[model samples]
Target: MGLINMATYLDIIRGTYEGTSEENGKRLRDALATDAVWTEAAGFPYAGTYVGPEAILANVFHRLATEWIDYRATVHTYVADGDRVAAFGTYSGTYRTTGKTMEASFAHLYRLENGKIVNMQQFVDSAMVRAAMD
Candidate 1:
């Protein structure tokens, strides 16, 4: 069997951060498996588990879009092995509720199956978010 490469993972990451437009969202959906699961770090306002593309879109993506202005994940480094990819980045946005802006480091781990992302876990500085919320 051939091994999964990092390029594909990078493509997914690139597409995800480009924007939240419908076409961009569609690219993200196409890269995810039907039963994909996304776990957000605890302490985050949207902290929870999201299953499937629809759930992820509704619970996580939608919240981000509605609650934050110019929310973007800017990746700085990428590490990959086998079907797993670890992306290090920063997330910057302005919280709608408080009109507070924040820039925090983040890491996202992705596991792919059949060339599609099946699982994802996010790590971020919750303190930064809390500060903004406060």
Candidate 2:
């Protein structure tokens, strides 16, 4: 297993957020291994622990698409050390159900191994999101 560069990992994450094609999704899947785990801290509406790259692809990507018409994440700060990368960002989207727009700040800690994302934990402002939905 080779060490994955932090910048490259960030680029992959950025691409996943910005890319709108099926090819992009495929690229993300290629970047991540089959056993990758993604977890979100408690408090957010979608807060729960998810395991496996397939789950992330399904719940984080597919399920989100159902709730949001257009979603995008903008990175504010990113720091990497060893095999872990931490990113602070804002995620903005239009809710498909109400057509309401919302933006929330978020932080993510990612662990990489063998040039693939092995684990990810996300933290977001749930109160703000709940207020926006109200």
Candidate 3:
């Protein structure tokens, strides 16, 4: 019984940040609840509240792919509290336009329901990301 593959909040959330950008994106969309809300931090390049997987894929995933070269989120730690999970990590990449590189710390919070992410919030130092673009 204990061996059952019950997915924890952190496991569901880790799917969103584990693989390559494209692969991780697929996992993210797959783990999203029907009305999931994905919030990008204000001042972030893709800052906004995206409802549903489609919106998030279009606004955040697609833009990141096109605007940044080799962009990635590497999670160093994961903390789970009941239905909530927090991923502490770093973002690194080179801006397509500027060809400058950036490494910024990030924290992603997720609330899951029935093994799917119902809400998510992003926290990061936008200035560090902006420095690379400029």
| TM-score for predicted model 2 compared with the true structure | 0.83
Q: Where is model 3 poorest over a 10-residue stretch in terms of lDDT? A: 1-10
Which runs in model 2 stand beyond 4 Å of their true positions? Answer: 1-3, 18-24
The residue pairs that clash in candidate 1, if any, are none
On TM-score, who's better, 1 or 2? Answer: 1
Top lDDT hit: 3
- The true-versus-predicted C-alpha distance at residue 51 of model 2, in Å, is 1.3
Candidate 3 per-residue lDDT, tens place, 33-90, comes to 9999999999998999999888988999898899999999999999887778899999
RMSD of 1: 1.9
Residues forming the 10-long window of minimal summed lDDT in candidate 1:
1-10
Candidate 2 lDDT score at position 91? 78
The per-candidate count of clashes, in order, stands at: 0, 0, 0
- List per-candidate RMSD values in Å: 1.9, 2.2, 2.7
Candidate 1 C-alpha lDDT tens digits along 82-104? 77888898988999999999999
Residue-wise C-alpha lDDT for candidate 2, range 62-130, written one tens digit per residue: 877677766666778888777787888997877777777889999988787877878888989867666
